[model samples]
Target: MKLLNVSAGKIQTVEIGGEKVRTAHVKMPRPEPWIITPDGAEGDERASHPDKLYAFARTGYGHWQAQLGVAPGEWNDGFFGENLTFDGLDETDIRVGDEFMLGEDVRLFVSGARTPCIKLAWRLNQPRDFLKTFAASRHTGVYLGVLDPGTVKPGDRLERVVHDPGMPSIADVCDYVAGVQAPVELMRRLLAFERLSPTLRILLGARLNAAEAAERAGRHHWTGWRDFRIGRIVEETPEIRSVSLSPLDEGPLCLPQPGQFVSVRMADPSGDMIQRVWSLSSYAAGMDSYRLSIRRQQGPGSNWIHRAQAGDTVQLKAPAGSFVLDPGSYHPVVLVAAGIGITPLMAMLEAHLARENAPAPVHLIYGARRPGDAAFLGELLALAAARDDFTLTQVYSQADAGDWPRSRITAGIVKESVRDTYIALDGRRIPVPWYESDIYLCGPGDFCDALRDELVELGGQPGHIFSERFEAAGMAPGEIEEAEVRFVRSGTAAHWSARSGETLLDLAERAGVAVSSDCRAGACLTCRTPVTGGKVTADLGDGSALLCIGRPATPIIELDC
Candidate 1:
């Protein structure tokens, strides 16, 4: 099929349904060859939907003209706002897994059908029912995902290099979007495709039912507390130790996604139960055991953990966190961490390297106080030595004569490392642009916030960066006016300092009242407690407070502890 036109649009104010709105829906054909990247057309401006990058097939312009009785001149090559308008290949003809070479070097894969939105109706000056009509017909064009990045121009022929007949066609997806019922097996097979757009995946999953879909997405793992025996412990550094855990029942634990953490419950020196969280550092694609890399701190809970033996048992809930890697991403991965924050990023690096077909490069920029304090230094160096795709940059704040650069990790170090990074693709070294790569930042709050601001100033995409900061340290006791706190369920009344910044969970422990908590941060909702009589600093949408981090905002408060 020959490429008819190439289009790109910018954000502009336009009239939509008698109201002015800012949108990039109207695209004008460009004369020069357009650069195609993983993010889509080089100059195209997109809205909230990032998944639908490029669109194909304006061959249905004739069909639209006949159906809507519109003038022939009204439909141009890019009237549908598609990036690359082509002929001959339409929704019905393209399968989800179909791969094609656009022009010479550009490779495009069929991801899904273009799901019409209100913007489409607005652009065409038609009623909202136009979206329904567009979806009902097979005239809906197929959306293309960039596989091999290159340049595309008008008059370039679209050559189909690969096609799998077993996969569902783009038309089938459009039909499903229009609320047509399909066989369960067909829907399952559609959902199985890795390249399918996430939006369409959710839609199909809803049609198939939520439970089965959640299971497919690895969200139905076991929850709540279970007994785990410490399998082994290794001292990674002078202050950081790695503890391996296995199910006491000898059953397999569900393999955790890289970058997840498990919450542990154990007794402190005072014989009182305390909960804490640590990031998992080891991942091997199996579920036989899990490992946590804990940094020794001044807290009693941490001291107890460091003193525990291998045979000891701790109550642990299933691994949970949103700061995990994107398995489907085809972009370069850059991991930045400091001190104990290296724990989760370590898991992410190892997991990415273990992939059978890791297409992109992975770079890690880590910092520590000194060589003695860096966790897994030997392992990181060994990986860098063993793999050509891996790059490591270590900066020590308290570096000696042996350490290179001998300075603290700064935004310049990160930006320069990524700026010079390259990925080996098809025997060619392609520079990994900071704007396109997926960057993960984990460290103290101030560290993350400062680096993020600097990176944004230096032309980094804020959305492409993901960060998880260390939990805020507990407040220290100080002199302040005492406030009355009442535990409604336990019938216990205690005095708490309003200015002390202590959480309700801490007050409960001091008052000899029992409360369940995990993470000791606002993350896990295990410490959810209802605020019965007064205001709290933290509130979940259900009017309950996260007792682990929630404090009394008022002079006096009551909690259902």
Candidate 2:
């Protein structure tokens, strides 16, 4: 590929799509004889960063002209915010770790595809849907890291110095980023490339691990209702126990993603099968069995599980849940847990630390009624001691003199934990902005809802804050008020009472109306159904109703279920 033009830009504010955006590379001009450094172009704003110090290269203007169906000169170099425009090499020809010789001395290593953000849509003055179309086109261009720094001018010849055949092409990376599912083998190959972006590698690695777990489970044909023998049970706290189980046939079991859960079915005294979903607390990698930390509740499910002994067999479904860590996100993580909610968060912590070149630091805030109620106190302390990037803060609502201060995990506590500056374990003050971190909340419904609402009130985006509750956490539907819900596709209607404490999906199931669902939480969109008529209230705001998490706001609701 021949370098047709080189460009750079300084930080400036520009108006795009009627919005003012401050960006350093708003309009990169073609600079002649650009000086290249190990960080990036000498005058470029994106230089000398560990993750994004590289330059971006896009195809020539002609390629965009044809793809966008625009007139000649309508779009030119730097329109897509690229630092370098090349004539010959397209995104399809570039692979992670492929090195290119620029001019006589400069070398650039292909890192990964540039992910399109809202800024690009604004820059193009296109509708929000254009972002989707742009990504689906697989022409987002590629990012290059400076391997051997030197100087280069316009018209410099670009030659391939090295190529790794095993690496996925830039197009493949784009496809993966766009939510296209890839085979396990392809994901593994992508993870093998060292020069690949850490974000993408971590993402691919997670996918590979999940796929391997599924493969192991599939080997034993373990699907639907299967018998799992209780392998071991250990008391975690005075009221909590960690139960380990393995397939009855002694076959390999699929490891669940951190924060995922499995449904366990046990026969009650009345000979009726009772099922309960519990979070898997243990890490998934290289695991032969599944482990769940259960708090002894008064419910029949928990009571039976606690009474079970080793060598006892119970029926269970394969592990599944949508409340999983986003492997693609590089932001720091804040895991908030209260009481037994620590189960899933512990799994997430383990998974994050086990990753190669772990992407971001983790801050864990856990609270319980007392020190004796903390389930994984020893394990969490050990993990905090081992990893410098991990910070643990414990809160006890009812603590003795020797225990932690009697402080409940409230909005105030959360705010303090995410402050801009905090004293580190080594006594050094560090600046860590909590708003930039992804916060995961798992605990009692009321506790989680209160914290989630508080975070949003504190300017936290709903999308960045993930939550999972063991039971319904919202306000109780006072006094029985019957509401009629009509399913358009199924031609079935059902009457639901606000006091029933049932979601739209629950009402549908009771009325024998079929609706697709997974996760049962609002995280997965599988249960999202359009509301053709009437109105419904939901914790999520995606225009459509998440049946699993939605309740009728109006007396008569129409669903396209």
Candidate 3:
């Protein structure tokens, strides 16, 4: 695609995880070290190319090009001081070594994908444009690392070295998706492909797989969806629910591996929404539905679950977590729970209790606010009484108890209870169980951390400890007073007084500018700001990155945000 008539765009949008980010706005070329930034790029971002300047512009934490005025074509709502915003030439299909002679001598080649950081997903104005960008520059854009960097003018003849149409390529994968159906093995192939373009690697592939499964569910494991209200509302606590679901679907239920989890996908009453995940806690019981222990909360997409009715239908993805039972029983299972941590535990316990040699029973240690705060109290007591293999201990730190303690669970107590054999938290262990025996865990972050630390110090191997962290241990006021940065796009200069705990995404959010972000976890690759000037260290072994999660540390940092 060729673009003409481009000039300058003001920094119209900025944000962090949809929140406005605020910092002392300073001039460009902020300062040295440029390395100390809130983020860096993912995948092959650091691997620069000598072809596409657009690709290079998209690489840094924040990127900008020297605009020598404007040229050709009159489209673009957000200027962002851009260089080449074009049309035509099969944009997504461009590749490295493939050059296009643009206005003047400015040339570009497909170098890499512009994996996004949170900055792109942030909301703007009232938030209408947040989703619009899904199809904007972030979507229909590719990076061009400059080969022979030169001044590019508008309205220049843009010619390209077009290759034969018919050739085995990842680009073909995009066509498959746009046409009839995405190949069942498309995701697998993309995952297997080595060093593919950033665009194809992320969007045309990663983001497209599960999405394709939803769009076309032929033979895909996630195709068989089910979530029916089966039973009455057995009970309800202040923040959670105990629902008994009888499988409404009459077909035989598909049995999953013990630890595998199911994804609960639901949309809000408002049409604009996305999906979220949840776990199932009951063993598969034929066509009849089992129990799902859920904690209702006020978050992005959980309002519906809180207000769900007894007979309300909910769509469920197939079971898919990496924690579960193995072929052979290890030994002396040790299960622990903090709050709702018992979800997977219940399912696992049901299976283990049924097996003849379920790894010498379990040393179950559960922590709750009070003995009465336990959710599955009745079921738990029954398991202990009915089988000699199972032993139960409870910690009701806030309440008194019989045989149960009046203190929170401690490593000392747990260590004494099941120090001898392999332990299972809720369900049985899978993958590498107790050096083949099994050690499993799942719970809130803080609880999991405290318990895991003690166990590890007691000599737990890396793979030996399997666990999951749900919520933040807590969200504290950011140490905003410690961050320092520098912007390097147009000119060179520096800024100070930035806080350390602050993320570039958050800074944008506070500034009331709309940046993009989703799945704040580092994986999704949205919210990518180019590192035009300085560098920033990211938590993910990868270098500088999306400001949404990146914490600024270095004395000076640069980004395209």
Candidate 4:
């Protein structure tokens, strides 16, 4: 490929969305040869994009000029803000990690595709939808990293010195970023690129996670939902109830990984379908049925569950969650729980006891309001009585005189237990220290947070501590205000509030509106929706918003869905 021009730009002020911002998106051809360095070409402003050293590509200027009806002499070389405008370098022809020698002096590696954003639209004086058009064109150009920097002048020949066919092409990377589904194997290959750009690596990783998730969803035992008969209901406590269920079709049930939960879908009193997740409380090793422990909370889902009886059927999805025990680790286990949080820990403890191999020593620190408030108290005590390696400490905040431990669980109590507890190993008893154990915490948000901080302060490794809470992790706090959200295509509307702490995607699910979403944290723009009216707090460059993280910032919001 021959370099047509060498362009560099100074930072300039531009207006976007009624705000003046400094950008370096405009470039002019230099009169003489430019000195290249490890950072970038000399005299070029690159602070706005530090992840990449330079942008270089053949911008298809003639094609776009004709398509957009630009007059002659307009849309010149380097008009797309590329530093080195090339004559014949196509995005589809080059792969990441491809090395090229320019004029036999400067060496650079193709990093990844230059992702188009709103700045591209502003620089071209086009509408916001131009971002999508540019991306769909798959001619977004390539970003480069300097390898052996030297002098490079206009009309310099760019000779390809290296090419790896196994690596993803620049066009492939652009397609992946443009919401096109890539095969799992291709994504894996992209992730394995040794010299891949950091920004592309992160994006590929999130896409790989989302792709694998979709594959797992397709591999689920049942699609949509399946009916499960309620075998029995046992009142573990006045507030907690355990229901055993088996598939009505008599098909084998996929055993849940210890600490995993399943979604139960049923109709409420109003005959509206609703779904709730409940942790599996039974040992999965030899289980013929699934047992879900539910607390009688003041909600439509819980109320319907409490009012249900045996012989009734409910729709169940396959078990899911990453909170399972580390079966491969031999580290001593510390299971801490409060209230209904004990359900998952109970599964872990029981699964450990049922293991054919020698299990790791476990210590359960359970807390409740009082002795009667603790579900599975008798069952846990029986297991502890039967095993010397398994230890149980019951902490009750309002325990009576007859209760064994009559105080709330604190860091002090945990420290004392860490010093006192012992594990039997090879006919010897060794003290189980906090730092050496893998601590699993589950409970209310505040309880888990406080305990996690205290444990970290007590010299416990933060990575050794894993936690699960009642709400979604990484949820951000926002002002509580009621708002109306309308999904135009679905013809559905719902009342929303920061008080519910639900994203628009979550609201769409509850409102029975189907919205395509993957990686529901806004990393992938699969859930991006057009905002026809009203307002939302988002980070989109265009007039669209990502429903996964976008929250209503106005009293009424309308989405094209």
Candidate with top lDDT is 1
lDDT of 3 by residue, 141-233 (tens): 444534344444434556775443332232344343233344556555554544344433433442443344234323323355565663666
Ranking by TM-score: 2, 1, 4, 3
Better of 3 and 4 by TM-score: 4
Each model's lDDT comes to 0.76, 0.72, 0.48, 0.74
Query: Each candidate: how many clashes?
Result: 0, 0, 106, 0
Q: Candidate 4, residues 59-94: lDDT per residue as tens digits?
A: 477667777888757776567888878876688888
1-561: candidate 1 lDDT, tens digit per residue: 888778888877765433345567778777776788878887888643455455656558778878778887777666787888877666777898799998999898887887776578766777656776888798887778888988877788888899999887888878877768767888888879888875566456556653332244374367688899887889888788888888888876777778888888887657788877878887776668888888889986678778889998888888877788766555678999988999999989987898654556888988998888999999999999999889898888888424256776677788767665543433355443555578999999789889899877775767778988876543333233566889999999888885665778899999999997657766646678888887777766576787787777677889887
Give per-model TM-scores: 0.62, 0.68, 0.44, 0.50
lDDT of 2: 0.72
Off by over 4 Å in 3: 1-220, 224-231, 244-249, 285-287, 300-302, 419-437, 460-462, 472-561
lDDT of 4 at 293: 89
- Which pairs, if any, clash in model 4? none
Ranking by lDDT: 1, 4, 2, 3
Per-residue CA lDDT of model 2 for 350-393, tens digit only, reads 88777655545788889988878999898888988988878888
